[model samples]
Structures are given as structure tokens and as C-alpha cells.
Target: MQKTERLVAITVLLQARGKMTAQRLSNILGVSTRTIYRDIITLSLAHVPVSMEYGPGGGYYLPDDYHLESAIFTREEAISLILSADISGNHNLFAGDTDLHHALVKLEAVLPEEYRIDVMAAREHILVDTSAWCNKTQEPTHLETIRAAVLNSYQLDVLFSDTSCCQVHPGAGMLWRRIEPHGLVFKGLSRRHARVGRWYLVAFCQRCRSFHTLRVSDIEQVYVHEETITPRPNFDLHDYWREARKQLEKLKPPIIFKLHVKAVARYSTLHGDVTILKEEPDGSAIVQVNAESMDDAISYALGLGADATVLDPPHVRMAVAQTAQAITKIYS
Candidate 1:
């Protein structure tokens, strides 16, 4: 590769990897260790914060918050980026990032007149709207506050919504809880839940003292502690999420109930991973699904209109009957 490209590559490498030894950088870049050292000097000369550690265990590193506004993208990459950004919920995914809009505007402004047409043409033909129907998409409150707590590692005092509070006394206030902010998990099209592009706060609850996952929509108010917090030992985001789901299963045992579905087409409303156990000759299916709770299971059965029937978990059947009676009484 060219020296200029190599320099850009080195900057990107350090930016991504956070730190790398000269030997390791050389191996990755297919250059001599001497060349790596020279490149480091070049980066430092260019005002990149390239720091070195003496002795063993450390080599070259950048500051924890070092970020360069500059980036290089190819013609196709630039077009793809524009198209993708256009569909990112009108730049709402970034929460409070005005820079995202600024960067996009700058990128478009600098593109050649001919290249601008290409981007606009692609967007005209291809629509990428991913909003859920029925206005079920939740507008989470206090996202900026919650996000800041996550970044600064501050404890959050959250007024989280609870089912008991909602049902028992509608006028009652929300429950107060303290969560040690870990990070925010934003859902995209990749996740199967009906509610797409929702934010989830994954943190360690002071009450539970373990890990907790609460939907940001469910959190009414968030009060952040200015004092920064130290994260727990061996806290891996992916691992914690995986284990949290497992714990959720124990607390609210998975309802492995069968459903009789008459829909000839696959129902998009059926959220999350589901297993199709059997298919009848008549375009109907008897499938097994996992719901978080009995109430959810009943809702699933009811949502199918007459097309679905819950075959197991007799309590769900009873609940369905009671709900139907209540509805009938209201309409009667």
C-alpha cells in the first residue's frame, strides 16, 4: 500500500484497537518494526495523541477519548452510507448527537454534483422505513440523561414503571430504583421484537445487586449521580446480556405453549424466535412459542383473532375465557 494510505490505516488501527505494540502493528501492516516506529512518529507529528509506555506490557497507545473527525470512504461506500443514514429514524438513533447530522450534511455537501445524483437516485428507488405499525413504537423519556450516565459510569436513580403499580392503583406513582449504569442496548431490525429501534438500559441494579435489563420506555424518570462509578469486575456486555436472559427465564419461566394458527401466510406480529412444530394439510400450523408471562401468552392467543387457539397451559385458557367474558359483558 502507499505511504499515505498506510498512515491513514495506522491511525484507524490505533483508533479501533485502542493500543498496539510496534511489533504487533508491524505484523498487521506488513511492515518492518522500524517502519512502524517511523509511522508512530509521523502520527504524533500530525497532532494525534500517540503515547508510549516504558518497559514491558505496553507499547503505543492513544488517550481513552482520542477521536479524529476525519475519515475516508470510497464512492460506493459514501453512497451506501448516505442511504443508510437516511433510514436511521431521521437521525434519532444517536439520541443527542447533532454531530451525526452535521457529518452527514458535510459529507453530502462535499460530494461531487454527479455523485450527489447517484445518492439521491438510490434513495428514490429504495425505501428503508422500519417503523412498527399501530404507533406501538415507544418514545423513551430522558434518553440524554440515561446515555450520559452510561458513558460517565454514574449511578442512575430511575423511576421505573411496574405492572403492579399500573394495575393495582392507576393513580399510584412509579417505583424508585437505583441502577449502576453499564451501557445502553439499542434494538434495530436485527432483533425480532415487534418494537423495533427501542433502547434498553443494561445495568447493575442496587436493589438486586446483580445485573438488570429495563426497557428505556419503561423508565419514567432518570436522575444521574454526578460521581462516576467503577464498573464491576469482568463485566462483559455480551456475556452479561446473555446471562441476564437466562436469569429472566428462571424468574418468569418460559411458557412453552402450543398455538393453533390458521394463517396461510407467516404472521409478522409473532415476535422473537419461534419454532414451527407441525403443519397441517389445511395451511394451518400448530407451533410452539415462548412468552414472558401468562398474560403475554393470553395476549398472543387473542391477537390471532379466531386464527389462533392456545392448546396448553390451562391457566391461559381460563384467562382467555375470563377476558372474553369481560369483553362480552362490556359489549352486551
Candidate 2:
């Protein structure tokens, strides 16, 4: 478990149970008593409202009237969160350092008496299961290590596969990269119905002298060096990600397609843009839409079926005609 997660757990435990001895906290968190002592000290330093008591049965606890500013989730909000945590395939957000069941136990303990019932009712009532039907969720294995390296500002040695497309195959040539990792992106699976995620590491590549994004799963090895790093000047992680997405978009020139549709012209614009240029005498709409490629444009037009006709672009018209002929042949 991460130190940050452990501190949060300790704070929740102390606030919920009134007081717990360091030894007990150690037992609960699976750490040494000495580590608990250190955490208590750290919490105190961070102004977490934690205090230690000295006596036979004494331990560390928060003052009754005292609570951290962050401990302000309302009963409804808390229940919603607990409900979300209970669902399988939820992000490790609620389950970090401990399972949701245990975390909810501590959470309910801290809640006011009136809220406890709501929490319990929510636990029994609502269920959200996000696990894919066809495939199990695959958690990225190297995300933690890479995130740690980024947070600690350590130089990282990465041995990654030449291509992410066939990452499982052994024969993909190895590429050694040294980077000062800045951010991690939990991108959705590029493949259809894939439950697994593809984690991308955004880092300053020393060799390339520019920021680079690489798949974490494709990375065959990771070596975090102790030496501190100098982060690039004026490089914002969010900005970089946005710019990278734009670059990817520019790879294929978008198409502007002209169409005449009998109806559902509005729906054609959902994925891109559709502007009504004119309305035909026969109650049809003449419109223009943008698509990433000719295939996308053709597919969108096809989806409109006989209701839509390609008005311009001779090449697209030819392709659609050929496709229509093929369909007609199959039917005939």
C-alpha cells in the first residue's frame, strides 16, 4: 500500500473509533508499531487533528469536536460513495490500501448516527457492476511503480517493446528508454469491448529531448534511479495530453461530406458536424457532415440507408455505388 493511502486510513480509523493504540493500528494496517508512530507524527505535522494519549489503555484519536476540513462529505454523498465502492470493477479509488468493505466500516463508524442507516440501506439497495461480460478487467501492473517514479522525481530506465499492437509476442525488438516520467494516463482500451486498459506514461525522454508517451504494458522492464530529476520548464501534463490528442487527430485528414437525407439529419451530426445547407422541395434536407475518413463518411451515409444519398464527392459516390451493387447482388 502507498504511504499516502495508509495515512488516510489511519486518519479515518482514529476519527471513527474515538481512540486506538499504535499497536492496534499497526495490526489493522499490517505495518509495524514503529511505522504507526511515524505516521502519527507525520499526520500531526500535516495538521490532521490527531493527538496521542498516555495511559494503560490509551492510544491515538481525534478530539470529539475536532475534524479535518476534508472530512465534510454529507450523508447522501457518503452513501453514494460507499455504494460505488461496493460494486465490483470499480476503480481502486475507494479500495486503495484496503478493501471497500473495511473502508466503509471505518467510514460508517465516523458518520453521525442518523447517516448510518442511510449507508446501510444504500449498501443493500444499489448495485453497480462494471465488469465486462466477455473479458475480466485487467489492472495495469506497472502503473504503481511508474507513478511512484514520477512522484519521487526519479530517473526511470524502461525497456519497452517496439510496438504495442502485438505486445504479447516475444520477438518484438526491445528498445531501451530513459525518461523523467511526469504523468500517467489511464486511457480506455482502443479495441472494441476490451475490458482491459492501456496505461500510457508521459515523460521527458532524455534521448529524444522531447516529451514522449509510451504504453506501460509494452514496457518490459523498469529501473527507478535514486538520482533526482529536473522537470521540464513550462510543461503541463494536461496540456501535453491534449496536444498529443490533437496531433493524433491530424494524422488523417478529415472529410467534408455533402448529403441529401429524407430525415434524421440531426442524428447524422452526432459523431461530427452536420450543417443544413438547404431543404429540398420533397421535404428532404441537404446537409454537410465531417468524418475522419471516406470510410467513416460512407458508413454514416449507409446508416441513413435509402433515406440518404451522397450529393457530391465522385470518389465516395463511386464507392457507395459499388457497395450498393454488392449488396444488391447478395439479395438478388
* Top of the candidates by TM-score: 1
Off by over 4 Å in 1: 1-76, 90-93, 111-115, 134-136, 159-179, 187-194, 197-199, 204-221, 231-234, 263-272
Q: Write the per-residue lDDT of candidate 2 for residues 1-332, one digit (tens) a residue.
A: 45765776687777666788875576456565678889888888887888778987688889898654434455666666556446533454223445435655666666776777887777677666566566666666677787667655689989886442233344658877677887677655322233345678878767657677787877878999998678454766667888876865687567777887885544433334677898777667888877667777777777678878888888888888888888899999
lDDT per residue, candidate 1, 244-308, as tens digits?
66865677776668777876434555555468888888877878877666776667667666767
What TM-score does prediction 2 earn? 0.51
- For model 1 the TM-score comes to 0.63
What lDDT score belongs to each candidate, Candidate 1 first? Answer: 0.67, 0.68
Clash counts for the predictions, in order: 0, 0
Candidate 2 residue 180 C-alpha distance from true site, Å: 1.1
Query: What clash pairs does model 1 have?
Result: none
